[model samples]
Target: MSPQEKTPATLPWLTDEFLQKILRDAGGHETTVVTSSDIKPMAGGGDNYLSTMYRVSVKTKDKEEAVSTISLVVKLPPSGAEMMKLIANSSAFLTEIKLLSDILPKMFSLLRETSPEEQEEFGAKCFYAKNTMPYVLIMEDLASKGFRMAERQKGLDLRHSIVVMRSLARYHATAIALHKRDPALVESFEENFYTDSRGFVSNATLPMLRSLAEVVRSWPGFGDDYRGRLLKRADTIYDDVMELMKPEGNAFNVLNHGDLWVNNMLFRYEEVTGEVRDVKFVDFQLCRYMSPGIDLQYFIHTSVAEEIRAERVGDLLREYHKTLCATLEDLRCADSIITFQELVDEYERKALFGFFVTTMILPILLSDPDTIFNPEQSHQKEDEAIVTKRISNIHFTTVLKRLLPIYAKKNFF
Candidate 1:
């Protein structure tokens, strides 16, 4: 039978029986019988490389009139065998399952206890999750609630950037509070995508760096010597990248939203002025315990426009540090672990990280879905070639050209 024609196995969490139980539990009415219908695929952000998402409409009632109708987004592992193999080889899927199922709830509960008045400002809530393979995470549909994704090509403007920075600060501070209250709980969080050698991102680093080196060789002013130096450096790029991801002396470490580009965040805007009011982060597959600079630098490089990054990066960092300090203070955690100066210093130390990740991800972020390869539609061999070509497109080259000199000037290479 063709791959499409073969009946796909139903994941345990996707069954109607499971949905009824969770829906009733969420509504706080155990006897309510929930019926789900119109299950359809949701267009996901390009970052969800190893999974697919579905929007499910659920009607809940207790043998009478409908009590309420709810929409939920269900994330499931990739169904294609090749894609499933990649996910199985990496830590991303399991890490996210643990994050949503175990860590986030505990962190949210602790935050509520420490700052009851501000409890509402915590992270996104997962309605239900099953950590086993054929993993599933059901979360409130942020899009239905008026949260929209930022444009990947245009990137985030100053106001949106501020909202996201504030949210990230609150998120990082929660980890700090949790660590202080119960160190053992956060012990396992240290092994993130970068730290795990078997993870997809870590394995992709060398090839991506080599691709960057190839791009550099074709630049106008670059010659053999420059290309040689870059190629030599590329040989050690993976190890260097991994080292940068490590926390330095217990100073500025926190549980970082390991992937923090524009596509991973959703913002709700004020309808009148079109100003950003609140933000929600999604796709925790890469969440890790690392220095805050990992997320900070990643977002700046991948999501902010060049002019905004060059002109206001210092201001943005200051804003992030201020919010982080306030959050830590509110949570009653030690605020002196890292000063603003130290944060800046750490950001500078890890500047190369932004360059590396941007080169690897910006193409996928900027390209349209039609232009990119779809593993579900294409053969594995053809998809590999298409992905390589997609990453080397004009959008990727343009951003690389814009960023190369900045990295050189900063001595980040």
Candidate 2:
């Protein structure tokens, strides 16, 4: 197909005709372009699309009551055919938008009724949905109010950490309560929106993992036994990482923000006064149904510093468990809460999962000029290969130092 004919399936909502219609429908004169300056590309947690943000200024009949200074974040479809093919196979692309729509009601209710403190703790406000096809999210432009988080300059402080922990607890608690209160509603929602059956990291990642493992084995200064153990266990490790689905048996699986790193949250602020306000979670692209460990592991290891991680790892886990239990209790969902014992047990069974996420994520987190910055010139895939090769060693050592003893103490092989 010609380049012009290479339609983006994800953005069915955007078209020249549609923009004219929206402009006409708004009954505004000329719809002053206001100079569509490109919003700076944000970091990480995306596989497809070159995301750009634009601000539009317009006047309407309800000027006294209307909200002006509308903002929108446009995600154009992937550019290269190769890249598009890669995206076509990965579920993260369209699933993120679909999942957002499914969970929007619960989010809206939480935002509307919850206290400011409670809102900070358990609410996500989705102001509007612009699903025209190849979806365009003309959202509550947070930047208009100066409510945005600067990228990780330092670790999450104790107060903020606790707030984030509590917020996560409330989010998971609501899901469990919903499940218990109305199983069919939860099931129906899950049915409508669930994980993609395939991910590039699943079908295409194992080979890369195996190649990286081999490269590590060949590197100098590596001991014989270290090489042997990693290679021998490579298959098992790859299997576990790629097949990071819901655990079988009695584990309580809930909705997890599959990529819950620190940057995903936008800190709400009082624009005029320049005061810090509430935390609004953004980027639901990687949300999924999985063990809570997946979310907790990604959040703690990636967001917190090593020293802080060491000091507060157990404390934070305990805090998360307690908050989770209390929220369940408040919702009359005590029976559904994953027990402290079970929580610890799952941690043991899945601490290795942290390594997988840390390695997979660090590239996007640490790399400069993210994937969307300049698609043609960037070497994200190459840089990712190097990081993957090195992270396996770092991840193994991290396991040996932090997770191994715990595994041995619990005798969970």
Best by lDDT: 1
Per-candidate local distance difference test:
0.72, 0.52
lDDT tens readout by residue for model 1, 1-413? 32223213453335556678787676666776765444678775454566888887766777666577777888887888866776666677788777776788887887787776755444456778777776778888888888888777787788888888888888888888888777766656666655653434544444455555665676787656555766676666677777888766656678888888887888898999987899988888887777888899899988887678768898898888888888788778765446889889988888888877776556666666655545454322334444556556775666677777777777556
Q: How accurate is candidate 2 locally (lDDT)?
A: 0.52
Instruction: List residue ranges in candidate 2 displaced over 4 A.
Output: 1-67, 88-90, 107-133, 181-199, 202-222, 242-244, 247-249, 269-277, 368-413
How far off is residue 113 in model 2, in Å? 7.0
Tens-digit lDDT track for model 2 on 174-229?
Answer: 77665565555444323211244333343333334444445545455444543454
Off by over 4 Å in 1: 1-13, 27-31, 44-47, 62-64, 116-118, 195-199, 202-205, 223-225, 335-337, 370-394
Q: Could you give me the TM-score of model 2 versus the true structure? A: 0.69
